[model samples]
Target: MAGILPKLIVFMAIFITLLTVIVDGESHSFSKTLPLRSKKLKREKMSHLHFYFHDIVSGRNPTAIKVAEAESTKTSPTEFGKMVIIDDPLTEKPEATSKLVGRAQGIYAMASQSELGLLMTLNYCFMEGKYNGSTLSILGRNTVMSEVREMPVVGGSGLVRFSRGYAHAKTQWFNHTTKDGVVEYNVYVIHY
Candidate 1:
């Protein structure tokens, strides 16, 4: 009877702690703590964002090598070559044409050494139009191969919270002389 009583008490405690909640989009109140993935919340839908990044890498921009030599540290990240903050234009450049569009403001830094290729990280924001104020992050290897690179969208902000998806990047043009280039991205996201 003692063991049975303890089990019954535990069951009742759990039952009492359970709650019913109603979220009205704008505001929400939580009576009980629940996992963020609770099905009681609204169902998640997939979202997509596709845009082109026109990185016209001007010579005026400081290279990572210059930064490393300038900083001259005895320890860590001794070789920095390609860390850059992006302020590129996002275009809806189809196969046939390219159009003026929004802007992409973000940072890309070298996270690891290049054994096969350079592994970089992205924390980028989209400004203007439907995706205004949305930010996406990624950790990907940068290689100028003909094959498209797939980048995982780790997380996001604004309308892209709880974001998880993949972005396909294709280099359109890379100028060896001027050090300018155009890269196109097709991003797919699922967020709540």
Candidate 2:
């Protein structure tokens, strides 16, 4: 009976180990033992998308709105602490009446006290052609007065899955009094 008890304990331990492995197999499929290629995300490619972003803060139908600001924001040199939420239009051309391609929807804030630097977190959601319903996320810094500002394309969804790249933004035209701007965006991205 003593020998039988020891054998039964060993059997229980082996059974539990096998059960755990089977239950957790899907969650740990890409563990150290498995190679990344096993998942089969192959034939990566790069794409460049050019568009114009219109940020209108003046008119009654503004696209970008100042949603929040600190008490000292109005007096600050760079308006640091002012945050704006935007649903700006993305067009094929710099003109506001150009063909619409997508929308830049997100928030940006003045994050630098010494310079007019903004922390941008937005998504370029495409609505035309093969990119319809796809989105590319941008999260980086933008120095407003600079000749060219490069922002990172962190990730994406739909057609641009597992994407990473950068976007070059050049202010084509800006109205000082109205605080409206038209920015040209050239995005280069790598995706599978």
Error of 1 at 46 (Å): 1.4
lDDT of candidate 2 over 98-169, digit per residue (tens): 999999999999999999999999999999999999999999999999999999999999889889999999
Per-residue lDDT, model 2, residue 150, is: 99
Q: Model 1 over residues 1-192: C-alpha lDDT tens digits?
A: 989999999998776555322232222453555686674446777987777777765666422221222233223342334456666667777332466455655555444443224455666576667667878777676654546988788888777777899888888887778667778888888888
The candidate that wins on TM-score is 2
How badly does each model clash, as a count of residue pairs?
A: 0, 0
Query: Which residue pairs show backbone clashes in model 2?
Result: none
Q: State how far residue 186 of model 2 sits from its true place (Å).
A: 0.4
- Locate the minimum summed-lDDT window of 10 residues in model 2: 27-36
Best by lDDT: 2
Provide the TM-score for each candidate, comma-separated.
0.61, 0.82
Question: What is the overall TM-score of model 2 with all chains considered together?
Answer: 0.82
